[model samples]
Target chain A: MNPANGGWLIALTLVAAMLLGVVHLPETWPGWLGWLRPNWLILVLFFWVIEVPHRVGLIAMWITGLFVDVLYADPVGLNGLILASVSYLGWRFFERLRMYSVLQQCGILFLLVLGAEVLSVMVLGLGSERPWSWHVLVSALVTMLVWPLMFLLLLRLRTGLRVE
Target chain B: MSALLITLESSTRLLDPLRSFIGSLVSPIYVVAESPYLLTNAVGDVLATREQLQQKNRDLERRVLELSQISQQYVALKAENDRLRELLGSQGRLPYEVLIAELVGVIPDPTTFQIIIDKGADAGLSVGQAVLDAEGLFGQVVEVNRFTSRVLLLTDRDHAVPVRINRNGVRSIAGGTGDMGSLVLENVAISADIVEGDRVETSGLGGRFPPGYPVGIVASVVVEPTSAFAEVLVRPSALLDRSRHVLVIFTPQPQIESNDANTDGVVDLDQGEAAPATNGVENAQAGAT
Candidate 1:
């Protein structure tokens, strides 16, 4: 398999998962299993941004954010801006992150997820005069806590998609 | 390398056809991705069956208590009406049409605090439609899509619902302060008759929402000396987070207004339009369909 074909496969899988994450309608509130949400999209994109920075750059994040914006009908460009910023940050630290073990990478990814949540709340809550709640912080914590599983999934995909 | 080059030449030529075929095959993946609950629903059913029974028991107890309170309210309302009638003339009752819809999901973000409902354009729902539950005003429809609509919950930070204290008729705008069950009364005078347990209802100042729907009950009142205003925290009347269904009222005002505009044009064309005749025709059409 050509390297270019492998990249396309990864891109296709990411977009498909992201879009599915957007359209999914939970029939009932499984508050117990609420932890199982596909926080995978951000982590996958993060992995690509770190490993293949040029291929999945700021533009890819922006488009994913816009897709989520349309799917959720949130204030337009809010999520896109946050995603692009995260991608940029991920690209900048790609070399540094490349040196770390999976467990260490998971710790840093937790912080990145927290930063993303804060950026989302700050952007959306600004000027709207809505009272800020601890829920945003809670969500950020939840996102970070899921880092190990998210990282493992991305690791599996990377190995599976590797071409000889 | 030579064999690969030959294969690439053939595949490059077929790329357009192959891409479209691949796109078609992958389209269903997104749809399947959207229903993550389908994977968990069967297991959830077995687990949730006992919990559902317990929830029903709790609901029954709540209903009994609500019934007793409602009876008390009716008696109090009748007494107030009699007193008001002696002071000022009675105004006729307002007519409204109610559409019932089920709550589908809570919006993922807390900033917007919107709920997506299953009803949409197909249900004759228009933007800015007022939504209410049996107890009180819940929120309004802000965005409408094909099969679903987004409702900006009153508890959302950006939204402001005009409300008045039922005790002294002190009016103030209530804004969401990032809580699922709370809102703050902005710019109310320090002397306002707002107290804990006071009922707050829509003032109907703006034609945005109909009058007299219960908004919430005052939870706490805090007055700071430095500030010229008082802080009133309210717990909304409807159990919004717990509510599974809501009523979207569709009053007949728009249709009436459009017909009146058409009547004016008809009268100008004909020397005298049959006023009583048009009334019967309009009434019959409204009744028939």
Candidate 2:
């Protein structure tokens, strides 16, 4: 695949993930269900970084995180740090992560997203004290649960677009 | 790279402009995300029966009539107050200016209870500006970007408002409990005169929020023998979960030089020339609209 098409594909996927990240649930939906929405940005970034380590690297992940931070109105660079760290780890262990089954990868994703969630909360606490909630932990679990579907979806997109 | 950006963002506002710039770049994401909700609303509006539309129109007309009557009374009272102040050689109070803002988004995080409104720094909305629904005080702006801003709702766990009982002037602090339906009064003396059904309004003690806007009503008061403070709960008057339109209020009298310049130009023309009574024509248009 030409480099230009792959790059646009990456951006399109990132924007899609960002939209899902901040999407509001209908009012009839229970409030607690909102926390169950998986952290889509991390999942997509991890998939791209693991599959095409050369194309999606630390800086790309960081920039996408910056966009997410702005979209969520979170402390700027907070999600960038999370994405950078996750991408760095993915880049380091791409071979191992690739060899693992989808279920095993979910375990890894659970841990990765959990760390990202906890780190964001702690950094936010640095400015002002905000109490911790189960959402931080629960969201990671839900993201882990969501990985197989995300993995297959992106897998098809990568192959369908021939995004090498 | 992330560490440096975070450090600069927190230590100084060196990254504030960059933040707003990024916010503007990504502004379309808000529209894309909200398309489903917007389409649903549009469909509902279009699908409403003729009778339903007429009923809604009649209800709105009646509300406007009631509000105009109250405003007329208020204008007369304001004129009398101005005259009395003039006789006493006192300064006149400026009328608070407000801009109508529409809700753009709700924070996805349920526990935080925040929202994004269409008005932002570009609209001169600043952090701590009071936001109100038609019924009562709703919240305050927390973060301002280029075209949108975030508001922490009155029921956010971290939000609190200094309020006074409208029945008597006894003041207390109403703190949110992360519930959409209620707020808790902090450190109310057990002997506090607050009672069930007492009307609560902003006291202007801290001055972040202006005085006299209705905040809530004291729903229940429980006095305990072991505790020094009584537990009082308030039901907010604003529909925190439902209101789509809000008003952001700020004192414009001293803030914008350009607006003052325009007003001055208008006044000069009115005083100096036969300007065809443009001011009266503008006022009539404003009233008709």
Please tell me which predicted candidate would have the highest DockQ against the true structure: 2
Question: How far is B157's C-alpha from truth in model 1 (Å)?
Answer: 2.1
lDDT (0 to 1) per candidate: 0.63, 0.80
In candidate 2, what are the lDDT values of residues B146-254, reduced to their tens digit? 8988788878766778889999999888887888999888889998899999999988654467788999999999998999999999999998888889999984433
Model 1 CA deviation exceeding 4 Å by range? A2-40, A52-60, A85-96, A103-118, A125-127, A131-145, A161-164, B1-94, B223-227, B254-289
DockQ of 2: 0.50
Candidate 1 clashes between residue pairs 3 or more apart in a chain or in different chains: A24-B34, A130-B157
Each model's TM-score? Answer: 0.65, 0.87
Instruction: Give DockQ for candidates 1 onward, in order.
Output: 0.17, 0.50
